[model samples]
Target: MSIPVAGRRQLNERHHRAALGLFLVVVIAHWAEHVMQAIQIYALGWPIPEARGVLGLAFPWLVTSEWMHYGYALVMLAGLIMLRAGFTGRSRTWWNIALGLQFWHHVEHLLLLLQALSGTNLAGRPVPTSVVQLLIPRVELHLFYNAVVFAPMVVAMLLHRRPREAERAVMRCDCALRTA
Candidate 1:
């Protein structure tokens, strides 16, 4: 589970920008899925069960699978943890905020997954539902969680790219703004 220090340093120093770019692409794409699903549900008047985002249209079963949701949550958590070592200072603070929020999201997904696997839906629903979803609807709750996590993540990336002088000095990665 522990990456060697030399290897970690190399990743941070030589490949941080490319790594972060790919990470951002993945995160943004996932966010797009949630947003599109919301659009389908709220704006287009599609039924909640029917609004399953783009992939769900092609793979209908995936829309109904708790495994898919849990897998995505796991991936998001892993990404945040793996990339965390490259951040420092204000960037690290903001990134930690996103990670903390995502931790709760992951827990909620775990609850849903466990309930689905155990043949029991939360609150006696046909499908697995999260704890918060007991109060707030799943669709809206997920959107809110994503927004909360994504906003701070975006801020972290911006701060990482344009760090203060002291932060820049400590950064091993070539990710800071280049002063010409």
Candidate 2:
């Protein structure tokens, strides 16, 4: 049996919400890793190599590997671009802020990745580092970038869930929060 157009639209909205929820989980987990690393460095006083986040604990090289960082940046950029269509009004505004910041962060990572691929290091360092990283250091700069991107993205998600009536009316996805 064929579904009505309205039923299909609802089904699509549900799928979007489900996918968005999963994407949020991934984003939060990544943020957690950065937070954990910062804690290790500042509060715990662990050495940088020893504080290599969760995955890096098992694979220490992963923390220093330019490929991993570049891959994650690309993933973040793609996720932001892919999910942008569903946002509106205030949510869209906040999302654009996050997206704009992530775009620059992506550029930094791309620069580092290119240097690594070309066997070059920034400022004569042994490892490839971004231009900003030359001044901020890798671990700290990464934490800062993650915080800036994550903050606006969180605001966007919160606003999207409890949007203005006009925004809700235009939203294609059923991700809005319901009142009790």
Candidate 3:
């Protein structure tokens, strides 16, 4: 059985806050991994291939798994789309920005996944490469992409929590802080 339209609506109306909290936790955990990977490369002077993040340290294959990366990108995109209705006014606008950026990020991961499966790397490179990766290094490009998407999401959350009177009037979810 599948969720009806009304059930999907309830996700944003009644369950928005909890869902958003869980989504943020996932986002932050992913950020931690990227940050750790960066630290390994820049601070500890570990070579690129040897600098696996926390989970990747134990499961080294995770670093090379295109499917894992694609899955995360898909999850992020889905989360952004699914929770968008909870937002209104300025929050909605910022959320849309984040959604748009995540769509592109998802596309990049899809391209990489395709290449990995096809065994035909972009531009004949041995490994998969994204469109922007042609100009920027993979680590730096992903860090930049995540930061851009996350910045707008944070802005949207802040605005959503402290919504103006008009926004509050339209909100179905109890996500806003109680005003004095």
Q: Give me the candidate number with maximum TM-score.
A: 3
lDDT tens digits by residue: candidate 1, 79-135: 788788889999999999999999999999999999988998888998788999999
Residue-level lDDT of model 2, residues 1-180, one tens digit each, is 555666555544656577668778988899888988888888999988799888889888888888898899988987787777778999999989999999999999999999989998888888887889878988889889998999999899899999889999998888898856
Q: What would the per-residue lDDT of candidate 3 be over residues 91-113, giving only the tens digit for each residue? A: 99999999999999999999999
Deviation from native of the Cα of residue 56 in model 2, angstroms? 0.7
TM-score of 1: 0.94
Task: Look at candidate 2 and tell me the lDDT of residue 19.
Answer: 62
Best by lDDT: 3
- Please identify model 3 stretches exceeding 4 Å from their true place: none
- Which of candidates 2 and 3 is the stronger one according to TM-score? 3
The per-prediction tally of clashing pairs is: 0, 0, 0
* Candidate 2 least-lDDT 10 residues: 7-16
Task: Report every candidate's CA lDDT.
Answer: 0.90, 0.86, 0.95
Cα lDDT over the full model 2: 0.86
The superposed Cα distance between candidate 1 and the true structure at residue 1, in angstroms, equals 6.2
Q: Kindly report which residue stretches of model 1 are placed more than 4 angstroms away from their true locations once superposed.
A: 1-5
